[model samples]
Target: MVAFMRRRTAAALLSITGLLVLALSNPAGEWWTALQQPYQSEDLIKCAYDKCIPEGDDWFMAHLNQTIHPFLTPQSNLSAKDFLWWKKLQRDPNDLAAFKRVVDKVFQLFPEGKGFMDSGSQRCRSCSVVGNSGNLLASHNGALIDFSDCVFRMNGAPTKGYEEHVGKKTTFHIMYPESAVDLTDNRTHLMLVPFKTRDLQWLISAFTTGSIKFTYLPVKAKINANKDLVRILNPQFIKYVYEVWLRNSGGYPSTGFLGLMLAIHICDEVNVFGFGADQNGNWRHYWEELKDKTLRTGLHSGTEEYRLIQKLAAKGKINFFPGH
Candidate 1:
């Protein structure tokens, strides 16, 4: 009888040990710890727009998935299968060797590329995702956008003279080789969204060799930006945005949408600006005149994406400011 009791106790201890090991290894362990502790006002997780509820909170838990890491660090590993899947998005050639070479060079230049901006303290980190929609024209949301802790802008959206309509404060600029532009501000981080191996290669070449000037079309040979503040988005995160968030809509998520997701993951409170069409229902950028009023979102499912944005807004997940 004593031997039987001892064996049962040993099994119970082993189970507890396994549980402890899992909690330490997984990032969700923080949430588990939060669940155990008494609900204190200071201990509550504060997000950009709302304070997360203590128990049975579906909204906060659903958005915060620790498994899906959004950025690529030097230690990140990409399997051949995942690489092949990512390359197919842009129909890039099947050249894993070439891609690895570029990736290696990129990490060598930017060693500290992993992780994202997170407020470790009780302060709520707010983020503003500013798109290039024509609705931003005359919207006068410049001051409102600059109020956030971090501002994310995409592509060739210029803010030189349109400071009143679109804020001058650009914390992070998201772009690819095709939409590349010179970032005059040293404080801004150049976040490159690589769609192909050549895109990664171009990032290296732009800063160092200036050898690559074309990718399906003419690209900038050299870009004037701070290399130390450079960041590359994880391909796995792109897949997550496409499969989970977008539900495999369009060719892929637009840069603006990607910026919005990035903000959702990082910021406690998120404010979206300069999305959708102008009052005239024309899809054009705020900086340019309406040359193609009939033009629609190509490659990306703009209509569906906007619909999802509206749903998220209705759910109070994000504050969506539809520009006039």
Candidate 2:
């Protein structure tokens, strides 16, 4: 019995040691990095495609202006933080050009949204990109976020009672084949971000008979359903975002960021909320539960990508509403 007690005690000690190591490493002090460029210059570089001189070698040089000198700040100065984070990812010219192309094609996907550039009459600004978090259950923020001209939501967003949480007007619903399995409602328009070439084939198969009438925006031109509204981009764009922006740049920028950055490259002003964290830093809660909720068993509950999201939110660059 004494030996058994000793063994258990050693195991407990090891467990505590491991946990302490993780907490320190988790929000590690090392990541508080400074950028090489000034904030204003980096902002100019971020919007360089439009901000820079007309067609010159100096265009790429604008990328050099991108550095982490001034890092994350509140919402008012997030664009520069995004640019700084993006700069950390050492993108080769080929990859960078490819990403820019994706940004360009997303423009065609929603030409109405892009008209903001020419007429300057009106544009969909201040979008509240809502994530499906359980904290939103009774919080009632849907209406506020949905009132925006364009709303993008994903993953089992049960818009019935929560309509007031984010708003009932879900303009776009990003989803996958295994959609209805979740508590998904019928109002959301499905936008599939395919993980496999097989997924593309499945879309084509269903699209032919008109099982799905919604527009398709694939990285490659061939997969687009309505070539007019299809908005086919080079696969390089997805590759670049995956490699540079998502992988190399500190960590994964939530789908919200990918979509927001896409939105900003086209739209005017963007406001983001309901992303990144639970009330605590747990980072795994759902919109159906409270901020402290542990969450039901699911794939999204234990993803490294999700943890990276929490880290960015903790940095305070983005607005992550805990209780909706």
lDDT of 2 at 89: 34
TM-score of 2: 0.46
| Residue 274 in candidate 1, Cα distance off native in Å | 0.7
Best by lDDT: 1
Q: Global lDDT of each model?
A: 0.77, 0.40
TM-score of each: 0.80, 0.46
Query: Quick one: RMSD of model 2?
Result: 19.6
- Score candidate 1 by lDDT: 0.77
Instruction: For each of the candidates, give the backbone clash count.
Output: 4, 16
lDDT of 2 by residue, 1-324 (tens): 234224434644664465456657767532221111112322211221332112233422332222221111111122433433443433322233343443444343432221222313222233456666555556655534543445666645655545546555554555444432222334333455433323334344444442433323332212222322222212233334445444544333344444544433433333355554545544553543344456432323224445544543454323345573
Residue lDDT tens for model 1, 1-324: 224224433643664465467677778645334322222345323432233112134754565555767787766677777788799988898577777777888888875665465445454556789999999988887756765567899999998788777877888899999999999988789999989988988998999989998999999999999988999988878877887778899998999999998888776667899889889888888888977677899999888888878877776667789999
